[model samples]
Target: MSAVSAVATDRAQADAAVVVAWCDELADITAEPGRITRVYLSPEHARVNAVVGGWMRDAGLRTWQDAAGNLHGRVDGSTADARTLLLGSHLDTVVDAGRYDGIVGVLMAIRTVARLTAAGPLPSAVEVIAFSDEEGTRFGKALLGSSAVAGVWDDGWWDLEDGDGTTLRRAFTDFGLDPESVGTAAADPSTLIGYLEAHIEQGPYLDRAGQALGVVTSIASARRFSVEAVGEARHAGGTPYERRHDALLAAAEAALAVEGICRASQHIGTVGTMTVEPGAVNVVPGLARFSVDLRGEFDEGRDRVWDAITAAFDEIAVRRGVAVEPTEVHRAPAVFCAPALMDALRTGIVSTGEAAPPALFSRAGHDAMSLGLVTDVGMLFLRNPDGISHHPDEFVAEADIALGLDALAVAVRTLTERHGTGPDGVS
Candidate 1:
């Protein structure tokens, strides 16, 4: 290989190693020992900001923690006033999470900016954001950090409490953040060129296609519902089978109905959490509550599945003589990738030596979905061979990480070429 090519190869290898090591180190900064579990506004969040912010400073970027607790780092473009291109992903993790899911994206963005600034300033400014919350493990409100950035913070969320009965507002105060200043995190849409996120596919699509990277077409629309079946508690032996109104039984049938309807309609549905009342095994369950999470490529399809689930709930309620109610707690509509950004990502993928990378819709919701409310958004997916995520077994190859970083850098360059020359001249 030529000297320049050899040098480039060595840099890519070194960057990949840095990414892997950072992931391992960050995994150690979790609330639980021996397991990764960082939630919103927690002490771990502050620790991670300190570590990642230090790296951002080393990359020669201005760093700050936004009012909403998201960490940010910015590198000036050819000019200080140039339009900004945002790159990042959430840093929070689910319980017992894997190392690479969202953390890798932030580290990769930092490394990408470090490489760009080492050479010279680009045509457009680049900002890397480490969102504080995406898993919503503590308060059960996903995308809290990104939503604030999108200027969509809901006042009602302040009352939301965690397992320890700590209100989100109290948690904010305890974490040294003011609840009222969250609006400061919002960015002016006019100042943004676009948002790009590099994340693991968390599925088998790219792995099955034997590709290292793929461009995202769109993110799935999702709806989460809390369903409850209410029935009178009765003595198991005294109550006849015909007279028994079992809430657990009704809930079981409804859960099955959710699965059947979603399967038939080609949508994704999950009963992630369920609770049964009346601890006594001899007494009939008086109440049953379960959480239903549904997602689809389109909002219309997702709503249709929800409609079917509602009908099923009605049927089960009537048969079992129980009252069933479903309360929606969360909903996010599908967000499509902007055409210009998608083309740039395709260019980046091809530049990585892939013939034609596949385009797939993301079944999982991302911070991009929230950011899409304010600006055009695009995503690049790295292959996760096992199609596993949100668990410790989630995996991505180091070679794929290197390729993903290369593609992301190329994407940034493509954007710079497209928009940089007009307002801010490319260096």
Candidate 2:
């Protein structure tokens, strides 16, 4: 190989190694020993910021911890006032999390900027953010950090509490941040060129296709409902089958109906959490509750499934002599990728000498959904061999990481060339 090609190859190898090492190190910064479980505003969160901030600085960027607890690294453009291109993903993890899900994106962005600025500045600034929370595992609220950046933070969230009974506001104070200053984390939408995220496919599509990367077309719309079945408690041994009203039985039927409807349709549904009241060996359960999560490529399809589920609930309640209530606690509409950004990603994928990438709709929620409220957004998906995520067994090939880094760098260059300094300057 030529000397220049050799140097480039060595640098690519180094970048991949750096990202993998960072993932391994962050995996160690979990709340549980021997398992990964970092959450927002926790001690582990602070430690990660310190470590990642140092890497950002070493990569020749200005680093800071934003008021909402996100870590940021900024590389200036040709002009200090140039509009910025944002790149990143969440740093927080789900319970017993894998190393790559969200962390790799942040590390790869830093490395991408490092390579881009090795010689000189580009036409616009580049900033990488490591969002504080996206899993909603701690306080049952996802996108806390990204929502702040999007200027859509809900003030009512202050009262949200964790398992330890610590409110979000209290957690902020304990983490040495003023709760009132979170608003400062919001960015002016006009100052941003666009937002791009690199993430694992977390599904089998890319792996099944024998592909290393895919461009996201859109993220699925999702709705979450907390369902409750209420029935009278009675003596299990003395009460006849016809006389007893059982809440657990009703909830079970409802759960099955949820599965059956979603299975028959193109949508997806999950009964993730369940609870039964009045723990007793021989007594009828008085109440039962389960959380239902449904998603589809389109909002209308998702709503149709929800309507079916509700109809089933009504029928079950009437027949079982129970009351069923389904309260929608969360909803997010589908978000489409920006055409210009997708075009740039296509250029990047082609530059890698790989076949033209296929487009897939994301089933999982991402910070990109929240950020999409303000700016155009795009996503690149790295292959997950087993289509696994949110678990320790989730894995990504090292070679794929290298390809992803290269592709992201190329995409950034393409965007810079096409958009010049800002979206309005596209030529």
Candidate 3:
């Protein structure tokens, strides 16, 4: 091989080694079964966070736990007023989730800072944040940490309850964090020049397109609702079929209606959960409840799906002489990442000689979306195997991870070199 080709190969191998080391370190933490369960200020999650805090401390980074349970590691730069380049991801996970899901971002940021510290002070500061809970596995709240920092989590949100009777505020105090001090996590708009995150694509778009990198254009809007059906319970064997007012049967009809709604909207609406209450073999169900999660590229599209779904449910309720109530859980509008940051990512991908970056929308929500409300936020999507994520089997090639890191480093370097991590330019 040519000398230049040989050097390129060597550099690639070195980069792969760095990513593997980070992945392995995090894997060790996640391998614990307790960490794999809903952490929710629970004993298991606290133990895991303590380990992570120690890692940060050993690196000479000062650590603090925010009111929302986010763990932040700070590295001071030339000026205290400097808005640091923020990196890292959530440490929380779905039950039995893979190690690399959210923890990879934190590990990558820590490793990058470790290298920078060895090289001497950077022009600007960099903060690695292991956000408290992004998966909502415990308390059914996503982006709790990032949202708190953005000043979006409020009193009502604080009282949010988990599947258990425990409240979020109680969980915070139990975890040795202050609930009232949650506001302190908010960043001064001027100091937050730009925020960047590196995460697995969690989808198949990049792998199918043969792209190693993804420049996220926007995060899709999501609406979640619960549907309930009320009907008279009857003995299955004693009641004639025509005289029966079966809630489960009505719920089944509503499920089909939901499928029709998704099909009419080209599969943007999804129904993931359905349950019939007083569930028994011999008794017809009197009450049924199901959840509908709908998402789309635009608010109008989402609204369209919502309207159709409600109309269909109404029609079903009347036809079956049953009552149906749909309760709104939550709704978030689509959020677009900074265009300038997207362009910067594209430039980095091109510079690395990787295939063209995929310009795509993230179907999954991220902390970046919450941060965008307060500061400039950007994200890079590392291609996943089969675009699958949130599972133990989710995989991303080492080569692709290296490619993503190279692109992330380029973007960070460019921002720091030009703007110096101050708030003046990022807006």
lDDT for each of the candidates? 0.89, 0.88, 0.75
- Tens-digit lDDT track of model 2 for 1-427: 1111211245667898888988998899999999999999999999999999999999999998888999999987787668888999999999999999999999989999999899899888889999999998899999999999999999999999999999999999999988999999998888788899999988999898788888999999999999999998999899998987799999999999999999999789999999998868799998999999999999999998899989999999999999999999999999998988887787677666675687999999999998898888999998999799999999887778887888888889888655545447321
How well does model 1 score by local distance difference test?
Answer: 0.89
lDDT of 1 by residue, 252-277 (tens): 99999999999999999999889999
Worst 10 residues of 3 by lDDT: 1-10
What is the clash tally of candidate 2?
Answer: 0
Tens digits of per-residue lDDT, candidate 3, 161-224, equal 8877888888888888888888888876666557788888888887787666778888888999
Q: Which parts of model 1 are misplaced by more than 4 Å?
A: 1-8, 421-427
Ten contiguous residues with the weakest lDDT in model 1:
1-10
**Model 2 TM:** 0.96
In model 2, state the lDDT of residue 112: 93
TM-score of each: 0.95, 0.96, 0.91
